[model samples]
Target chain A: MTTSTFSERGAAAVGSAAAAAVGDGARHLIEKRAAAVDAYPAMDAMRDRVREIRLHTLAHLDAYLADFADSVEAAGGHVFFAADADEANAYILGVAGEAGAELVVKSKSMVTEEIELNGALEAGGLTIVETDLGEFIVQLSGDRPSHIVAPVLHWTKEQVGHLFADQLGVPYADEPTELNQIARTHLRRIFLRADMGISGVNFAAASTGTIAIVTNEGNGRLTTTAPRVHVAVMGMERVVPTVEDLGVMLEVLGRSATGQSLTTYTNLITGPRRPDDDDGPDEFHVVIVDNGRTAVLGDEVSEVLACIRCGACLNICPVYRTVGGHAYGDVYPGPVGSVLSPILFGFEGREELPYACTLCGACLEVCPARIDLPSLLVNLRERVAQEGTAFSWLDRPLDAYEFAATHPTMWTASIDGASLAGRANRGGWFKRLPWRGKTWTSVRNLPAPAVTSFRRWWKKHHGA
Target chain B: MAAHTVSVLDATEGPIVVPSGSCAAMMIDHYADLLSDDDALAAAARRVAGRVREFTQFVVDDLGLDGLEADATGPITFHPSCHGLRHLGLRGYGERVLDHVGVERRPLEAAEECCGFGGLFAVEMPEISGALMETKIGHVEATGAETLVGYDMSCLMHLAGGMRRRGTDVEVRHIAEIIAGEDEA
Candidate 1:
């Protein structure tokens, strides 16, 4: 769906969910987040440092990535580079096939979502179960994550209660404790029996040839440990220079992501289980996927690669808060998604995602990486304007507006034209109009053109 | 029109004040970059950009808070459009304009948030826009003020539309009009 339709649907959905704990959750998020950032008075400095580190790393990404790959190799792990989604999926499937893996447990990896891994694995007749509670719920409902950080922000207790009852054959319960316990029971069976596991890398450290995964749940550990074959997918840009750099990134990541000092789980894995190690996969593989990331690295929006996937931009974004995440129609959502998705996937159908924001600059202030999301959105808007994808309808009206706005005579005439049109109309508003303005009148009435334009009134009475 | 506006700005080097914050912000922040490929136009745009000012800012800068004489009765609140609040970093100039006009000021909750007009965005995402407007209007209603005031007329327009649709008696006015004391009636 286009942004309009998505927003239209989202509005109805949010309105209904307001009395159903969504409001409480939003309130908690607001207060906790305020406290989180406010407690760290030097949050801006931390953000700046992280951004600088990311910028420097992205500039030398090839070297860091190569170093990371070699490090992984030295640590007794294999690395595969996939240029596209299909390649990434095929490579993972090939690894799963070699391991003779059937049931594969997955932690919440948006990279997997980006590559549509579950579908690919399903087609290959492999069962993939999402081990993260929220992902499991989303998987059960066959629904997309509506918020990047809180996947089921769109799902209320009542909805989840119903979903669990219907899908998990559990006794219906709306309480958080009951719901979580129910999920824990179901996901544990999959965790133990799964032959392979897949996860997303949050930060890959070139210094140690290590990958760190941050999660609030133990599922990440369970998913990484239980399977004999472990596969991790990472976008090429999510690498840091050193373990110390990873430490700094972590300090900001949890704080910025969910206002936590640290996530419950921050596991730094080097390779499969060593002989001394009690339990881990004998074979470990890291699938480094470009999938249009390298293209985004050199462009005007390369700063988007500075994103830490902390979802701070998403949490602070008003557009994401209102329309939710699905409106973006991309793996990533909110401010970062607006910039990154268009650059990664091209802006054919999803042009409105960039324009979806009011250019509020809220995302910029709260971002750990300090990626100037609004600026990048504007750049994307210009690119979409050039492509004439979703902006073609805007071309003529914008052209006419440009003509009228810049030409003093035309500008002067247009005011009078508006005055005349105001008089010609019902002396109030066009309740509903056709053509370009069709949507404006859908929810709110547009005031009829003024009887006298401000410029005209200023010029005439004030002698401008 | 672009050429003419550029020329006009060139001709009148000062005093190009606009009531709409977004209008001023576009020229001030975006015009040169928008016209970057055309050297002359871009240069001209830079000339125009440097001189433009938002209305409330202009009012405060030129006249100070003591310029106006009209005393507005009861409670009044100034709504800060996102363009003014976030984009241009406008803080209290609009309210200062209202104060200059002798209007009683009431603090609005969520004052710096966008009213969701967003030019065509209000139309394109009417549902979300309307939702935000509802939240804003709820704040306005919470203020229990007879008048809703703002620097941008588009914000007023959206608020007014919501008020009308909701059958509320609240009045929305531009800071310029309020400063002129035109709403004393």
Candidate 2:
């Protein structure tokens, strides 16, 4: 079994070498994003438009889903509503079986990652290849994706060189151009030989039955068209009402994800190959995976559904930059994951994930969807506090604190008593502390309380 | 607890001056939500929240003070605590005060980033918190400023602790403390 990244040993390994790389990468993305937003005068207005469209679609999701399904079917494509991962995987597997597919190529899809679709297909005795360059490296090395946009961000080029040489039996090349060429040469063969392709839907337009797949490497286009059978797995919340709404979302998504005015390829697939079309999939199937999104929609954090998977939150999250993504131990990492994970996947085992944030509000500022991430984190913390499961140690101490705070005498006396104690210590600093406070003193010395309590000073000076 | 705080704040006749930026944020941003179940209490919380102001914010905006002329120790860099900077919109209050004083203010790189002193978070997840603190301190060191100042004491204490442990002699002070020009207590 893989060791938990939250384990003491696992956490200690983070924040040193990884901090530099991740911090630099995040800084680079943020700088570019700032420049892009600065250049586009209507960027903020477009963000508002995208947010309204998403919230509107979510409010009437049933109608939109029905409309999307009908439109897809009308255009000679099949749509299956999967209630959970099991149903989604089963439907996709059935499609592959009916098509007599042995090889499958997949584009970059976080929703597919959420469903663990690749493992399910591989388990069914089909060879699967990740066509996106970052995803391909992650697939070849058997490593989890460390970032949303840049999946293998934590992997250095030297490491990729080693991975390629060992896994692909090719000469080790550390330069980015050489590495890109190697991956392109390798994935080209898979694309030609693959019988089925699975891709993620970035934004599925309900009005026209069109699904937009945004990518910089053009791999999404290949994955959708190269194979005879194409399957698109989308989180149910990915749907928007109209093609115009899709365009508005696309505008923010590209600028927010990687600072590009527009990605190199934005493939809008309406249906399967028509008789008039030259090259496209012979058949098209869309698996709209609800998984836990509908449940989340009824909850307080329904606003998170408006997210277009831009990865802007991760790029600006200070904690994400410091500790890296695997520390989150979820399919989605960074700010969005912290709020969405515990709520979607029960908070029993991974309760600490929500508390991982500093509530810095950086994610809120950069989020293209304008999701209030810090407030959501605090909301989850309130839940954790009420449950008293994740932070059971704080329950009694907080109870005492609440009691003292409620009582004026106890509050004053405690402050005065702490002040007296502080006056006894030299340098007014405690290098070591007892019990639970040692976690703090273990890193930095704590300042002692003031020699005179503020209340006492006020009374002595003003006699009020 | 929120109800009790709201009642106390409601009884107050004057503007509520909060020395800590985070506490001011808790009142202004969260108190109403915390008491949302009771319409009267929620309204009272909002009233009190409107009156709440951080120390430097009160000094600059409410008092209409441009600057305080005082003898500062050395080259000073400011750290914008997250709550004061983002929640309360106290971004320029302290900086304007420092500028008025004619002190040498070195610009902090990534000044808006958090110092990782998130109350219980500092103790709960010290590994990650310490990592963030370390990165922030590294930025502080890069500025080569002798004194680091911010409006929030909690952030100052957290960064000061990390600076102490790292053996950086840089003094940590609240913006008010620097304005007051008080010696170390």
| Top of the candidates by lDDT | 2
Candidate 2 lDDT over B31-59, as tens digits, reads 99989999999999999999998998888
Error of 1 at B154 (Å): 2.2
Q: Which ten residues in a row have the lowest lDDT in candidate 1 chain A?
A: A18-27
> Best TM-score goes to which candidate?
2
Q: Chain A TM-score per candidate? A: 0.91, 0.97
True contacts kept of each: 0.56, 0.65
- The residue-by-residue lDDT of candidate 2 on A64-130, one tens digit each, is 9999999999999999999999899999999999999999999999988988999998898888999
Which segments of model 2 are wrong by more than 4 Å? A1-10, A16-19, B183-185
Q: Any residue pairs clashing in model 2, and if so which?
A: none
| Candidate whose DockQ is highest | 2
Residue A378 CA displacement from its true place in model 2, Å: 1.8
